[model samples]
Target: MMKNNVSAFVKAVSLAVCAALILSASAVFRAQAEKTLDQMQSELDSINAALSQKQDDYDSLNAQIGEQKSRLGALNSQISNMDAQLDSLNAKIRILNGQLLELNKQIEKLESEINVLNDRIQQALDQIAEKERQIEATKQLLLERLRATYIAGNSTELEVLLSSNDLSSFLTRSELLQRVAENDDRLIRQLEKEQKELSELTRALAADKAELVAKKEKVEQERTSVIVKQSELQTSADAVHKKQNEIEAKRNEVNKILATLDTNSEEYRRQIAFYESQREKADSAIEAYIRAHATTTVPSTNEDGGTAPQTGDGMAWPVPYNNCYISSYFGYRDLYNTGNYRLHKGIDICVSGGSNGKKIVAADGGTVMIAGYHSSYGNYVTIDHGNGLVTLYAHASVLTVSAGDHVEKGQKIAEIGSTGDSTGPHLHFGVYDNASGQFVNPLNYVSMP
Candidate 1:
C-alpha cells in the first residue's frame, strides 16, 4: 500500500509539473500572439488612414471637376449669347449694306441730274452771249444810219413838216421815235436778268452734289465698322470653345484618378478577405482548446477575476464541443489598438484542438445586421437579437447569414478567420447592449464550448 501511495504521489507531482510547463508555454504563445495582433492592428490602421486620405482626395477632385463643369456650362451659355449677338450683327450689317446701296443709287441719280443741270446752265449762258452780241450789232447799225442822216442835212425839218402836213403832225412823229428807243433798252435789261437767274441755279446744284458725296462716304465707314465687329464676335466664340475643351480634359483627368483609386480600394478589400481566412482558423483552434480544458461549473469570476454581467436574453453557449481556448480577451487591449487611439472591444477564441474551417455558431437567435468586411473588424457579422441585445462575430472566413436575416440559437453563422486586426486564425466575438450602446464582456453570457 505504501509503494502504491508513493507511485500515486509521483504521478501527481509529474502531472503538476506538466501542467505548469503547459501554462508557461501558453503564456509565451499568448505573448507572441499579442505582439502579432499589435502588428496587424498597426497595418490595419495605416490602411484605414490611407483609405481616408484617398477618399478625401477623391472628393476634392470631384468638387474641382464639378466647379469646372459649371464654369464650362456658363461658358457655353456665353457662347450661345455671343452667337445670338453675332447673328444680330450680321442682320444689321445686311440692313446697313442695303441702306448703303440705296444711298449709292440715289447719289448716282443726283450726279446725273447735276450733269444735266450744268449743261442747261452752260447753254443758257451761251444764249445770253449771243443775244448780247446781236443787241450790240443792232445798236451800231442804228447809230450809223442816224449819224449819216444827220450829217447829210437832208432838210429834215421842212420835209418832216411837209410830210406831216401840219406842225402838230410833225410833233407826234418825234414822240413816237423816243418811245421806240426806250422799249429797246427795256428788252436788253430783261435778257440780262434771265442770265443772272440761270447762274444762281448752277451754283445751287453744285452744293447739292457735294452734300451727297459726303453722305456716301459716311455710309461706307459704317459698313467697315460692321465688318470689324463681326470679326471680334468670331474671336470671342473661338476663345470660349477652347476654354470648354480644356475644362473637359481636366474632368477626364480627374475621372482617371478616381478610377485608379477604385482599383486600390478593391485590392484592399481582397487583402482583408485573405486575412479573414487565417483569423477564422485561429479562432476555431482556440474554441477546441477551451472545449477540452474548461470545466462545466461556471466560474464566479473570469480568468481576469472580473465579474461580467449576465443578461438572460439569448445567453447561451456559442459552440457544442469542448476544448476551446481564449486566444485573446476583450476591453481596452493594446494588441488590437493599432490606431493608438481606440480600445479593443471583443475577445478572440481558438479551438486549440480542432481542424481549420470549423463552424462558428451563433450564440442565440437574432437578426443579422452586418455580414461583410468592416475596415477594422475585417470579415465580420453583427446580429440584433432583439430586446437590447446584439452579438458580433469578427475575423470570419465565411459568413452564412446576412443583414436582416433571422438566425436561431446555435446556428452556424460563419467560419473562423484571422481577418482585420488579427495575426492568426481566431474568432473575435462581442456582445453589445442596445440600451447602453456599449460593448459587454461576452464571456459573461456564453460558456466554453
Candidate 2:
C-alpha cells in the first residue's frame, strides 16, 4: 500500500510538470504572435500611408491637367482671335494690293501723257527755229531794200520815169519796185507771227509736262505708302502665325505630359492594388494567429461562480432583446443593389422597438481577443472560445469590454448601434471556424432568441 501511494504521487508530479512546460511554451508562442501582429499592423499602416500619398499625387496631377486644359482653352481662344485678325489683315492686304495696282495704272497713264507732251514740245521748238530762220532772211532782204532806197535819196515815180529808156520800160520798173517792197514787208510780218505762236505752244507743252511729272510723283508716293502698309500687315500676320505655331507646340507638349501623368496614375493604381492584396494577406494572418493563441486558460465558472447558459451547440444568442429578427442573412448577396455580388459573412440582427442601444453579449465563455474600433466593423469585439471557435460582434456604438478580458456567455460586451458600414442600428454577428480557416453561418451554432 505504501509503494502504490508513492507511485501515485510521482505520477501527479510528472503531470504537473508537463502542464507547466506546456503553459510556458504557450506563453512564448503568444508573445511571438503578438509581435508578429504588431509587425503586420505596422506594414499595413505603411501601405495605407503610401496609398494615401499616391492618391494625393494623383489628385494633384488631375488638378494640374485641369489647369493646363484651362490654359489650352485660353490659348485656343487667342488663336481664334488671331485667325480673325489675320483674316482681316489679309483682306486689307488684298484691298491695298488692288489700290496699288490702280495707282500703278494711273502712274503709267501719267507717264505716257508726259512723254507725249515732251514730243510735242520738241516739235514746237523745231517749228520755232524754222520760223526764226525765215524771219532773219526776210529782215535781211528788207534791210537791203531800205539801204537801196536810202541810196536813191527821196526818189519818186518821176525820177523812175526819168531813168527809164522809154515809157513802157519806166512803167515796168515802177511796178516791180513796189511789188518787191510789199512782198518783203508781208514776209517779215508773217514770220514774226509764226515765231510768236511757236514760242507760246512750246511754253504750254512744257507746263503740261511739269504738271504730268508732279502727278506721277504723287502717285508714286501713294503707292509707296500703300506698299509700306501692306508690308506691315504681312509682318503682323507672320507674327500671328508664328505665335500660333508656338502655342500648338506647347499644347502638344502638355498633351504628352498628360499622357505621362495618366501612365503614372495607372502605375500608382497598380501599386495600390498590390498593397491592398498584401493588406488582405496580413489580415488573414492576423486572424489565424489570434485564433491559434487567443485563449490560454478558460475558466469553467462564470464571474459569479455559476455555470453560464449556452444553446444547443454551446453558444448563446448575442442579443437578448425580444422580438428581434434577422435583417440580413449570411452568404452572397447584392447588399448595395449593385450588380456586383459580395459575401455577407454575417447575420444582422434588429429588434422591433429599435435596435439602438441594444445590448450585445458573448456567445460563449471565452477570452476577448479583439475589442476595438475598426474602419469597417466600428466598435467591435471578437471572442475566442476554445477548440478553434470564435465569434465576432460588430458595428456597435459602445464597448463594455477590452482585449484579453475573460467574458461569460450571455455577458454584455457591447451595445448595438449604426456604426461603420451599416444602414441602421443592428448587431453584425459572425462566426469563424479557425479549424476550417473560413467563416461559417452563425445560425448553425446559435438559435434565434
Candidate 3:
C-alpha cells in the first residue's frame, strides 16, 4: 500500500512537472507571438503614416489646382474685358477712319476752290494793272488838254472866234472842245474805280485761300493723332492676348503636375501591394508551422471529418453590432480574383461610415484552430467546431484567443479593424469544409440578423 502511495505520488509529481514545462513553453511561445505582433504593429504604423502623408499631398495638390483654377477664372474675366475694349477700339478706329475719309474729301474740295480763287485773283491782278495803266494814260491826256487850254489863253479864244469870220463857225468850235474835255474826265473816273474793285477781289481771294490751307493742316494733324491712337490700342490688345496665352500655358503646367501626382499615387498603391504580397508569403509559412505543431494539442475530432456539415448551414452573425451592412458578398467575385479563377470565399460586413471598436463573435462553439495575423486577413481567428465545420474571422484589430483555445457561440473573439489589405474597418467572415479543405460561402452559414 505504501509503495502504491509512493507510485501515485511520483506519478502526480511527474504530471505536475510536465504541466510546468508546458506552461513555461507556452509563455515563451506567447512572448514570441507578442514580439511578432509588435513588429507587425510598427510596420503597420509606418505604412499608415505613409498613406496619410500621400493623402495629404494629394489634397494639397487639389487645393493648389483649385487656386490655380480660380486665378484662371479671374484672368479669363480680365481677358474678356480686354477683348471688349479692343472691340470698342476697333469700332472707334473704323468711325475715325470714316470721319477722316469725309474730312479728306472736304479738304480736297477746299483745295480745289482755293485753286479757282487763286486763278480769279490772278485775273483780277492783271485787270488792276491794265486799269492802272489806263488811269495813267487818261491822267496824262487830261493834263495835256488842260495845258493846251491855258496856252491858248483867253485872248486866243477871242482871236479864233474872230478868225472864224462867222458866228455859226465859232459856236461849232466851242461845242467840240467841251465834248472832248467831258470824255477825258469820264475815262479817268472809270479807270480809278476798276483798279480799286480789282484790288479788293485779289485781297479777298488770298484770305479765303489762307483759311482753306489752315483747315487742311488741322485735318492732317487729326488723322495723324488717330493713327497713333489706333496703334496704341492694337498694342494693348496684343498684350492682353499674349497674357492669356501665358495663363493657358501655366494651366497646362499645373495639369502636368497633377498628372505626375496621379502617377505617384499609383506607385504608392503598387508599393503597398508588393509589400502585402511578401507579407502573405511570410504569414502562410507561420500559419503552416502553427498548424503542424498545434494539431497534437487541439484535435480535429469528428470521425466523419471528411464529410460536409449540413446542420450548421445557418449560423450566427459574426459582428455584434446593429445597423451593420454587408460590404461585399461571396461567390465568383473579383475579390482575390488572381489569374487562377479565385472567387471570393468570404463576406465582408461593416457598419455605415465605420465599424471600428465593434466586437467580433464566433458563430458557434468550437476550438480555436488558429488565432494570429495573416497578410490578407490581419489579426484573424479560425474556429473548428465539430462535424467538419470551420469558420474564419478576419481583419481584426484586437485578438482575444490563441491556437487550441476553446470558444463558445456568440463569444467575442476580436475587434473590427482596417488591417491587412483592407480599405476600412470591417469583418471578413468565411466558412469551409475541413474535410475537403475547400472554401464555402459564409452567407450560407451565417444569419444576417
State the TM-score for model 1.
0.43
Q: Rank by TM-score, highest first.
A: 3, 2, 1
**Which candidate, 2 or 3, would have the higher lDDT against the true structure?**
2
lDDT (10s digit) by residue, model 3, range 286-325: 4443343332222233353323344445467888667889
Clashes of each: 43, 0, 1
Quality of model 2 by C-alpha lDDT: 0.80
List, residue by residue over 11-44, the lDDT tens digit for candidate 1.
Answer: 9999999999999999999778655545554555
* lDDT over C-alpha atoms for residue 278 of model 3: 49
- State in Å the error of residue 344, model 2: 14
Which window of ten consecutive residues has the lowest lDDT sum in model 3?
A: 333-342
TM, every model: 0.43, 0.54, 0.56
lDDT by residue (171-256, candidate 2, tens digit) is 89998988987888888888888899989989898988999899999999999999999999999989988988888888788778
Residue 354 CA error for candidate 3 (Å)? 5.4
Give the C-alpha miss distance for residue 390 in model 1, angstroms.
Answer: 15
- Model 3 misplaced stretches (Cα beyond 4 Å): 1-221, 238-313, 320-322, 326-348, 352-354, 363-367, 374-378, 383-394, 406-409, 419-424, 428-449
lDDT of 3 at 158: 79
